[model samples]
Target chain A: MFLIIVEKSNEVIYIKITKIAKAGTLESNDILIMVMPNDSGNIELELESIVMQQFGDVIEQVILHKVKEMGIEGITIKAQDKGALDYTIGARVETAIKRAI
Target chain B: MQKLRRTMLFMPGNNPGMLQDAAILGADAIILDLEDAVSLTEKDSARILVRDAIKYIDYSQVEVVVRVNPLDTEFGPQDVDVIARVKPDTLLVPKADVEEIKLVDIMLAKIEEEEGYLVGSIKIIALIETALGLETVYEVIKASQRMVGVLLGGEDLTADLGITRTKEGEEIFYARNKVATVCRALRVDAIDTPFTDTNDYEGLTKDTARAKSLGLTGKSAINPRQIEIIHAVFAPTEVELKQALRVLAAMEEAEKEGKGVFSLDGKMIDAPVINRARTTVELGQRLGLIER
Candidate 1:
């Protein structure tokens, strides 16, 4: 089971990724992700929605979105994961975006 | 004096993916390993791979260190000879017993003399990974003037001690605390072992904080993702920076007034506090937190 919790504000976005697997260690079986737009838009929510819709099919998606109704310039995400997360897989595309920003 | 080195990231000698990710990880140093990470059958190939990576990679900001195979290994001396020739920032000697330290010192001295290189130009970091090694940390740290740091290799230490490497680092606490204290007494850098569970941020953060509290100058990173956490733990926060600056200013003011002692924020300030302030400034400079 995997869980994604997103808390958004005018200044930052707090994300917590929780996952559990048959494997004892998270070294190779799990993925955690968070994303934000570089140029500032409703991109974080959009990105979160897109990721959830895509990987939601393969992995569990317990996503919680907390979008601020005011000025938001940057995004900050924290992913607390339980399994091995890859950089290229669907679960990590948004994470790559976060790293890029 | 050099500023503290906070994050030392490890890259397996033969893993190109890890090597490629290292320089951009924002770690203070990158330790390319040719030891335990490589199999006996792949040792020679790993050495070549490490050498090539060193020669080609920019490593513009990160200090580069190569963990050569242990002295007893057939490939160990050869690994050192080749790496010393290339001249990375430092050489990390594994299983650094007293004998091994003496051996590496002699070999490095010989190489420096034969090649007309500056004697002791390359820094040495002795990794204490075995029970025997832990028993002789002081002698090992003192064996060579080229020694810049001492690293605790907990995984191997635990294996040697026949214990499970736990998350709390209890099994290796004695060794870890000993190495760190020894380094502090010797006035050299001490590095903590990596937390192998790379994905566990809570675990990693908690461990890094513990390592920092033990007066460790740095902690090794098993993955690029661990760099930020390590850096944040070691980096001077705004409060620390402000206090440091105040203490420094008080000292300068006292000197100007011809007084030997100064009071800062209603507390007497002395050499140790001043030294800490100066170190904070140096760290900020080295880390680019402020304009030099």
Candidate 2:
């Protein structure tokens, strides 16, 4: 099972699912947390941190692409996702990305 | 599997001028890069531009290849949809894995099967730039019979390996050689990495030559100037042509004499030698060294 919490100011989002899981954690000053887990079997992934905060889009794109590129089949990402602190989101995403891969 | 454009010049998918100029650049092929070159904000725009370019532009001699973001990215599946709809000469996917390869193949297959395009009509060129990709090269290569070649993408490879860049090529030689060896064994073309230094013509020449010597069928080009250099290095020299012809003539004589093997220019010629000669001829023609 995987548990995810997305908190944005007064808004909080949480998700929990069960399956084979690959997880990552990204947190920074801008975006608090984003976790991604893949439900696909026959694949193992580890999350790597992304240090740069300014380029969240680039980080996200890289991570997403790396996941698809690595073939993680099915994945569920839980984001304690925040905004503005892209560096944090990037780090969280990279870990999720690495895990998904 | 034919000699791909010596220069597969990359045009940023978001840049209209570059894409327009790319058609006129005389590059054998143009790869409208939707991956590294385009920023995340512009991926959608880039896709539109690429689709427009494919639909409107008359490429003539220039082959069109599109480098979609890796399958792991949000854009990969959509990118394939767009490219497959456009049906460019080839679809370039970066950081491909066996599953991704199968995914792209399945998509392309579904598209073609429904639309009646030949199964292998649209070529697939996988860029090997990750550790997992390197480890799975053999499986990945076999994932698609439509796979025409394997591309060595250096920048990403460096990132994947956590290594810094060096101009000497020493750092990448092993990977480069591995790509070539695998391609050769599978009888597929292996494309060498692009030379990032666009202004260094001499450097480009040397790099192209090195790639040729290392058994790469061709190298990628970030600019038009590098294409001719790659083509020149890939073209067979006059001496090679002479030797290839001698082998062919000797083989013909052997066939006439009902002998399976013979000596050509005091060198032993056998089935492998004859096959090699024929392959050279085919490759020479593809390279435009000989007029078909």
Candidate 3:
């Protein structure tokens, strides 16, 4: 039960080094996402996952859905998965998109 | 409906595995930390992840508490703005500054208005860690209508006092007792600080026992391993439960016999004893240790 006493973090200095951005982690039940600019004009997704056999398509769907929800295109995405849940996948993808844009 | 909060487990805000596994760990509450646990660079990611976790994950088995960073820091506003909309059971405000807490209450009201969450539905817990905070413990407890509890931060309090914290907790006795007593006096929950040495179960037991002896109702836990021990310390023991059952039964019989007090185990069962026995019996029933 907390109220927002707003203090803006001055530490967030956004210096975009390049078009590539990353978020999430390689830990168990997590996914590492990398977003980079691509001239292909379509989302190119590369994925590796521990539970690929059981839920690869589902995990990939979650990633694509989040990427679409953020209204992003013309990027190549690489997600290294360690069996992350749908929420984790969505969060990581959203974070990477924010960082990239 | 006595909420037994013997253990409140703190999971890092950024970790997916821990958050996924947290509810099944048997803690009465899980605190997802966006404070000291997350590094500066990862704050945004952690906050976003935590928001998604609360939104999608079902943490209804236990109370969900989000420990936002100190409101004086920049990350705190977003922590409260985003997480409060998701409706966590409580938000633990670090530092416990009375004025800041008041400001936070104002902001939470605005968020609740925008999100259509009922005003004062979410709760606040004050983290008593500094001498100045301890001084304003009463004010902090009264800062908001949503205030539910206050937690002692032993490491921070010890550091503030310029004293070394011992496994025996010699340095934080006054702060612990003061917060515990004041919280009780204000009719709010008094939660003890986490035992930092996760490896030392025996020390944790002793430390928890000492806190319980001083009237702390529950303890903040650092590890899942500490939950059982803390619950053991706070839960009504079998002997106490049995005695409480007997006391209540006797009181029931005495009531039928038109007696105001009765003898149980050669001791007079009076109002206070009956109240204690009722609490114990209710707790045992809640834990399924006794038939309702």
lDDT (10s digit) by residue, model 1, range B74-184: 999999897887678899999889889889988988887777899898889999889998888989989999898998999888999898989998787788788889998
Q: Give the per-residue lDDT of model 3 (tens digit) for B162-266.
A: 899888888888988899899888988899999989999899999999999898889999799999999888888999999999888899999999999789878
Question: What is the CAPRI rating of model 3's predicted complex?
Answer: medium
Winner on TM-score between 1 and 3 is 3
Please state the error at residue B61 of candidate 3 in Å: 0.6
lDDT of 3 at B192: 97
Instruction: Provide per-model DockQ scores.
Output: 0.01, 0.02, 0.70
Taking the true A–B contacts (Cα pairs closer than 8 Å), what share appears in each candidate?
A: 0.00, 0.00, 0.93
Which pairs of residues have clashing backbones in candidate 1? A26-A83, A26-A84, A29-A84, A30-A84
Which parts of model 2 have CA positions greater than 4 angstroms off? Answer: A1-101, B1-3, B113-120
Ranking by lDDT: 3, 1, 2
In terms of TM-score, the best-performing candidate is 3
Q: What's the lDDT for residue B35 in model 3?
A: 93
Query: Model 1 off-target regions past 4 Å?
Result: A1-101, B1-4
Candidate 1: tens digits of C-alpha lDDT, residues A53-97:
455433333222222322233443333333322321222333233
lDDT of 3 by residue, A27-96 (tens): 9999999989776456678889888888888887898777666666677788899989999999999888
